[model samples]
Target: MDMGNRDTIGRRILIVGGTTEARELAGLLVDAGYEVITSLAGRTDTPRFPAGIVRIGGFGGKEGLARYIRENCIDLLVDATHPFAAQISANCVAAAADADVPLIRLERPAWKKPEGATWIEVGTAQDAADALPRGARVLLTVGRQELGPFLAYTGCHYTARMIEVPAGLPDDWRVIAARGPFTLEDELHLMQERGITHLVTKNSGGTQVAGKLEAAVQLSIPIIVIKRPRLPKANAVDSVVWAHQSVTRIFRTG
Candidate 1:
């Protein structure tokens, strides 16, 4: 869609955001004189706020999102959520279509298995739980929502690390509440101190928290990597800068 003679001065962008890239892109667009609105899932008790306007919680679904876009007159829709957040990404595609707005996805690349690392790639959290052996001391980094499958596996000991401590965890399971961009030294110390034999995580790629993979390799700990869920096709980019540029191009062409 050509926005002929249109400018970025008053153009409004709605970013379906939860990742660092989304936060960064919002800053860029705001600086470029675009009205940016960031939407968060609100699963976390406290989320890192991004520049520009912020809205918390789901859009109901695609229909709700489409209505919001139409009512708010959103000029562009940017999907920059987690790679494994397939539901939101799918919803963004449908909502953008229904609202007749341009949509761009800024998804980071998936993590590749490091050299000499023992990586067991699985399709789902349940598969990762099943792949664990009995008596294993596991480091679970797959987030709180995914803990249900692993809860049934009583044979393994779990040490879950997340941004927030989830309620109703088993008494025996250890919880580490922290944010990411962890150093290799810190990850090594945590794994060694906890006697972690297996590291289970989603392959939500980024330098943030990538130290765990390196730490697992150094300590000879096997890693269970959960594959990313499928998302609908869109104009996708891999970095925040590219997303910013795409928005600029859209306005320039229009």
Candidate 2:
């Protein structure tokens, strides 16, 4: 499988994306003179795409993805998909291998601890809620999907920061319906406004949405840090830069 001269005129890149890293990677690769086509899962409405071709919905599973790769003559398959997306990653591995399209993964960095912040690590959202102070005003910075586990607990107040309207929120729960790249100032203000003395969130690392941690620190809030979900074991690069280098290398080898 000689995928030659990726640097030549225009090479096609298929980025399976629905995350911040995916979009950022697409834009960077497109700027570097690649024909980048981003595919989304269509779970969200009116998704914004990079400055290139955009396709929505699944490839109808692995076989469909392979067919799309062959029919489109895709040169590179960049798995910029979300970390928790194990199935699609496996599909990318199997399908791209079947199609003989070179595949790579764009992984985001994980968050680390900083000084002067009290952090308690928890395995589940329910554990987080349990660890919070009784009657504490809580900032549930974890996404809406995980909040249901905590709904049964009435020990603390929950202030959930979410992008969409969440389901199964208790009558007592407070919701912040907004998107983010939330500034530290705004996050601080929100924390203060909601009377947040305890915070809970996943370590969903990326500069696009990490401001809340800084806000939590400045406010001297206790945070229950839900660990990041593990990704599939594969040949993965930690950034778009690494993926691009691999793209060039893959072509050079054959």
Candidate 3:
């Protein structure tokens, strides 16, 4: 991937990024002298930015995104969003096709159930809530946006963790505001201190927040894992390096 002397100087790329892979890819492309633009969903109050042009908020929908691609003369489109962000990812696929731009999806793999772990896998957030036992003290690692389904489960107590505090939470539910890469020890301490009986989270993969899975196994806590939503088919890669190479090859061949 010798991007140094390539004809990427005038090539413009658009990255629909929010995950860590997106930031790394943006930096790599920017360093390679490609004109890069990264778009964020604006869901987070303070988001980590990459080393290139950054745009916050959505482009309406698939139609709006295609319009943006055409209007901006984008040569390549990359979607490096969260795995659970199905709607946006689907939109990216449709928009790229509509705009006739080469699209690449940098989606990280989902987490697998650990050995000796009691994982009740479900398709949706509501299913997870329904699968929980009555009067359970649950530790919720699912994002704030996905907390709606659990609200109806008045029989359980929830300790929800997220980067930002979402509004309209129940009075009895506890909230922890923090970011991840939490160590196993930290997870163990949190679960023990809170007396967590069950763990609820999405199988978002990546090592950044995987400590909870190991901790749950060690603590013998039943985990209600929400399966990832089905996304539109696209040219998807699982790693940043692969995505970078794909982008380079597309630029060279196109």
Q: Write the per-residue lDDT of candidate 2 for residues 79-134, one digit (tens) a residue.
A: 98766566898899988889998889887876776577888998777778778877
Give the range where candidate 2 is weakest over 10 consecutive residues by summed lDDT.
1-10
TM-score of each: 0.95, 0.86, 0.95
TM-score of 1: 0.95
The regions of model 2 sitting more than 4 angstroms off are 1-9
Give per-candidate clash totals: 2, 0, 0
lDDT of 2: 0.80
Q: Cα deviation of 91 in candidate 2 (Å)?
A: 2.9
- Tens-digit lDDT string for candidate 1 (41-124): 999988999999899999999999999998777899999999988998999999999999999999998899999999999999
lDDT by residue for model 3 (69-146), tens = 888888899999999989999999999999999999998988998999998999999999999889999999899888
Model 3 residue pairs with clashes: none
* Model 1 pairs whose backbones collide: 3-254, 4-254
